[model samples]
Target: QLIVVFVSILIAFVAYTSQIFVLWNSLGGAVAHTFFVLAPFNVFIIFIYINYALTCTTDPGTVPPNWMPDQNTHFEVKRSTHTARFCKTCNNFKPPRAHHCSTCNRCVLKMDHHCPWINSCVGFENYGHFLRFLVYVEIGSIYLFALLSNRLAQIVEELHTSQIRPSATEATFLSINMIMAALVIICVGILGGYHVYCVTTNTTTIEGWEKGKTLTMKRMGKIQNVKYPYDYGVMNNLRSVLGPQPLFWLWPRTMSGTGLYFPIN
Candidate 1:
């Protein structure tokens, strides 16, 4: 996991460095144009690193030692059992939407999954940061791809209309950077898109799988209709993960809720 994190950072560093070099050299006297392109690119890069660091370092919310369910609030119990959900491993009451992660060796609140790149669980506390990291990565990669493509087109034009040709070294670096950007776009695009859907619907990856199972059982006439409790509505669900302020959704901040008790639909 550490290796993966290191490699991801290294790739970002290399791509950023190579793009700046290529752009500076290629757009010789167009300093204003360079700034125009780099201003937003740099912002995305900063956000990407910031969110990544937060996601890696933040605790994904853990159950208090010897914690028990509150009788005042409605709490989920073990399926088909009246007793509160419990983790034998943690020896503590499991909160609603919480799951025991074998990797972390504890129960995590609203756990989405264990991400290797960040070397942490995407759960209640860090989920916003995780999502921001993905958003920034995808945006930055797309920006890089556009810049690289424009440079490539210029090189091709120069070759066709003039005797000058781009240096082999620059071409090689450009190719590598472009390939890396494309991969990030495609991979992160799909991942980010899925998580966006999950957030809008107020569903975690684990709950999504459970929902599928429930549907199957219903279809087989083994169970009655079931509804996911967390889905308040499209707008409210988005606010749940991203916070109440739409203006600060992309900013670094913790989400609302105690992670132990969530409002139901």
Candidate 2:
């Protein structure tokens, strides 16, 4: 989980830093450019985080078998439809929102795809970064598209105004730029589509299997259904991803009923 968060932060840093450098170059040695450039990046970062939060997975059956309400503890565990259940695949009880990832060798909460780019699982911890990356990536693509389009337009304008034919080197450069822009557009389309799917349905790739049409337990919490056992509200859902914290929803070993606890019918 920590690894996921670190990797995501790293990715965001790279994107923001690279854009800042570009803006600096465009500003031509103006220190004032820092403010103009950083503000949008900041806004983009927040936007990315909110978008990611909205689409994060909320697995219903992640509660483990050892879980039990602790009356002895200060916090009273509320009776709810949420139950502690077992995953045959994991061969142990799981916390809510946690799912077994064959690649990660353990379950992750609100698990998104294991991003090869980051070399880490996009789980609850770094979900914010994942979403940020998506947003920035789209922004970057748009930026590149505008840049290439403007260059092409300028070339066309030059051709119309002047009798000189296009030079071979200039044409080759334009061709490369067009090709790069096209690739970026395609990649953005695919990523944006997938992100949209994940957001409306609210399931990550690690949790996507449970979102199947048949309404299997594997797919139960993907939709916003009150009938589902673990329909915790937005706060719980968010905590489910970020950390159980005082709630002890994540793996709290010493705490009673950490892994699996019977549901209060």
Candidate 3:
């Protein structure tokens, strides 16, 4: 319920605040520019919601009872990848790269990290949608920043030159929009950059942390040293996660391979 409310408020704030400012700046020129430049954000908005729903609702994949690796050959599996194969809690053979999610109380394939904001674990099945959500938000927030900044600049230029002055209501609306735009851009842009790095480097937040932890554990002689696998170069890694088509990279869709097992470098 807390996550639901947070998501709801975020959506409402973005939609209502943006529309309010647009309506407030209803001059012919402003409306024309915004209609073309800002209207397309509606699609982005829809995508945000769609991706959010898919991420939260879609299971982060679980290994069934007594499940074995695929033997038939659609996805070739390397037996060497199955190193850490047991989960004491689930009392089952945990697949390679699978981790137990305490929140969901299950093992998630290619487990990334549990996101509290979304109230879900970002794992193989819905990782693409999670990335898409970040992309759309950054794009939309940046667009809003551009639009509002231009409007504010125009107002300031005219007022400073003694040509025209904005009314009190107009000034207030512009100020609010500017603040909102700044908030979105700063907050979303930095966060989106982290996700972008994760996608490019073929690592998740959890995986990155585990990499460091594994190094520490190995140094302390707690565990044998093991090299991190699953990196298939830069482009291949992106394609495997974001799908093949460049056009549909930002589109809401599933990734190329199943979440069960992944090919490694």
Best by TM-score: 1
Better of 1 and 3 by TM-score: 1
Ranking by lDDT: 1, 3, 2
> In candidate 1, which residue pairs get closer than 3 Å at backbone N, Cα or C atoms, i.e. clash?
none
Which residue pairs collide, candidate 3?
A: none
lDDT-wise, the better of 2 and 3 is 3
Write down the RMSD of all candidates, one decimal each: 1.6, 9.8, 4.1
The lDDT of model 2 is 0.50
lDDT scores of the candidates, listed in order: 0.86, 0.50, 0.75
Task: Mark the regions of model 3 whose C-alpha exceeds 4 Å error after superposition.
Answer: 22-34, 69-84, 161-173, 214-227
- Encode model 1's per-residue lDDT on 210-246: one tens digit a residue: 9999999999999999988999888988888888989
Clashes of each: 0, 17, 0
What order do candidates take by TM-score, descending?
Answer: 1, 3, 2
